[model samples]
Target: MNPNPVVAIAGATGAVGVEMIRCLEERNFPVKELKLLASARSAGKTMKFRGKDIVVEELTEASFKGVDIAFFSAGGGISRKFAQAVKEAGAVMIDNSSAYRMDPNVPLVIPEINPEAALHHNGIIANPNCSTIIAITPLWPIHKVNRVKRLVAATYQAASGAGAAAMEELEQATRAFLSGEPFEQKIIPHPYPFNVFSHNSNVDPETGYNEEELKMVKETKKIFGDDNIRVTATCVRVPVLRAHSEALDFECENPITPKEVRDILAKAPGVKIVDDVSANYFPMPKDASGKDDILVGRIRQDISDPSGRSIAMFVAGDQLLKGAALNAVQIGELLVR
Candidate 1:
């Protein structure tokens, strides 16, 4: 790898794509040159990086020719179509979509949880699902110390996970509803403003689990390298615009207390403890938005479990930042390290 690598952003105009640019700037990743690639329609647009205007180009077979690292936040379709081109160009593709995450050869990595997995990437590295990243980042520390036998996560995802248009639609729909006007939805399946629904991803009729939920289950196992570690998730789309929140219950092998769990997470990288029982304060989407760290709090022993081995906690993280863009950038940083 070059001491200062040439970086490319595949979906430079989209939500996560824009955040990727910001992360590179914020993290001060060494870059010899920057290329911004988007759809043809988004071509000719210019995005700024390191105080210079870089024109967005149409993504093509030749886009990755000189890019040392290609950060792909475009949809899976684009990644599927161009990933090989990226690899053929000899650029390390850090993808932030579901395209190659489950591929046997590809490594699904969250730097905090599985940085070593990235060392084995065969040209492409997959970033886990946004909800999965937010949920699992905090789990890794505890699971590293005390074995986690099972995981139960219920995510209250935000509109940002869908894309920037969905976030705008939510705002538009909210204003229309406030004025007593009928609102039409575009990005999401159901009504957006002041409403919540199951995740919009296709559901498996047999298991009654949505694609988002299934990703959490499968990706967790793959990242943890523990096929036997039981995992289940119920993912829902909430009215929030940015960060995603999850309630996780961990079933461990031995008894653990709330203080022990809290102490573990307090020192864990990429985590922020927000539990303030005196003021009833805890992790909130408003506080987590635009932040790099995943906020974890509301730690307590599971009241329903008599074995004293179960712990419950609430976590919030910016799905676009730490969940997608920052995580991919972190992987890119690791690649050059």
Candidate 2:
């Protein structure tokens, strides 16, 4: 890798893409130049990085030439079409889309959990799903110590997971609802104001699990290298505009306590403890938005399990930062090191 690599941000106008640019600047990653690429409609716009304005260009087959690292967040279709071109251009493509995550050749990574995996990437490394990153950042430390036997997770996902337009739609819908006017649903399938629904992803009729839920299950096992972990998840979309929260219940091979679990997470990387019982404070989306660390709290023993081997907890993290852009940038940093 070049000491100061040239970086490109695909989908530079979208929510995660914008954050990808911010993260690179915030982290002070050594960059000789920055390229912004988006769709034709988004092209010609300008975004600032390192105090300089860079014009966005329409992504084309020639875009990746001479780029040392490319961060992709456009969507799966764009990734599928352009990933090989990125590799052929002699750049490492750290994809933030679901396009290549499950590919056997690609390393689906959360830097805190699988930094070693990034080293083995065959030119393209995949960033895991946003909800999966929020859930597993804390879980991996515990699983390493206790050997998680089974994990059941329920996610409270935000509109940010869908995109910037969905967030705007949520805000618009709320105002319309309060004014006693019907809001037309556009970005999200159902009514958004003060309503919660199962994840809007296409569902599998055989197992009754949405794509997001299954991504959590499969990606967790793959990242941990333990297919026997027995992971299950339920993903729901909430009215929140930014961060995502998840409730996780894990049955470990050895008995564990809430205090012990808390202790483990405090020492873990990319985690911040926010548990305070007396004041009734824990991880919340409002607090987690714009933060780099995943805020974790609400640690307790799973009461249903008399065996004392089960622990439950809650976590909140910025879906756009740590969940998507930051993680991808972290992978790029790994390549540089």
Candidate 3:
């Protein structure tokens, strides 16, 4: 990696791609140059970075030329198509999609957790799923202190997880619902206004688990390097426009308490403790929107476990930031360092 790298963002006009540009600027990443690559339809558009307008270019195999680091936020197919080009260009690819997450050759990375794993990447690193990142950020610290044996997560995912269009659909649908006007749902599968449904990802008939839930389950084990960790999830799409929230319950190998969990998370990186009992405030999507840190709260014991080894908590994080772009950028930073 160059000391000051020429960074390229594939799918630069999308929600996560836009955030990737902002993260680089906000974090003051040493960028010798910036390249914004998107689809042909988005090409010729201008986006701002460092008070300058950079025109978005159509992504091609040749887009990786002279690019030291490439942040890929496009869909899996795009990432797969251009991956070889990126590697052959002598640039590192930090991918946000699930294209190569479970690949043994690609390291699944969360900077706050297994950063060292990123160093072993084979020219590509994979960011974990948004819900997995939100849940596991706080859980990693606790797992370090008392090994987590099992995890059960129920994710309240925002429309933003689908993309910028889905977010706009959410807002537009809400207005249409309030005005008693007919609205057609295009981006999101279900009627998103004032309603909740299972995650938009296709469900597996045999296992009864959606792709989103399966990603959380598999990615958590890979990132933690603990296949023995039992994981299950029920993912749902909520009406929020941004930020994802999760209700997490986990059983540890040893006994753990709320105070211990709080203390552990308070000192953990990329985590913000928001557990307030008297005021009855906990992590919320509204509060977590646009935040870099994952807000965690509602810590308590899961009484269902007779052994008193289970704990429950709530967490929220910006899906486009830490869950996607920021995490990919953080991996790039690790490479540079």
How do the predictions measure up, each by TM-score? 0.99, 0.99, 0.99
What is the per-residue lDDT of model 3 for residues 239-297, given as tens digits with 9 covering 90 to 100? 99889999999999999988899889889999999988999999999999999999999
Candidate 2 lDDT by residue in tens digits, 1-337: 8879999999999999999999999999999999999999999999999999999999998999999999999999999999889989999899999999999999999889989999998899999999999998899999999999898999899999999999999999999999999889889998889989999999999999999999998998899999898989989999999999999899999899998898899899999999999999999999999999999998999999999999988999999999999999999999998
Candidate 1 has its poorest 10 consecutive residues by lDDT at 186-195
lDDT at position 40, candidate 3: 96
Superposed model 3: Cα runs more than 4 Å off = none
Residue 309 local lDDT, model 2: 99
lDDT of each: 0.93, 0.94, 0.93
Backbone Cα, N, C clashes tallied per candidate: 0, 0, 0
List candidate 1 stretches off by more than 4 Å: none
Candidate 1, residues 1-337: lDDT per residue as tens digits? Answer: 7769999999999999999999999999999999999999999999999899999999999999988999998889999999889989999999998999999999999999889999898999999999989998998889888889999998999999999999999999999999999988988989988889999999999999999999999998999998878899999999999999999998987899999898899899999999999999999999999999999999999999999999999999999999899999999888889
TM-score of 1: 0.99
Superposed model 2: Cα runs more than 4 Å off? none
Which residue pairs does candidate 2 place in steric collision? Answer: none
| Candidate 3 similarity to native, TM-score | 0.99
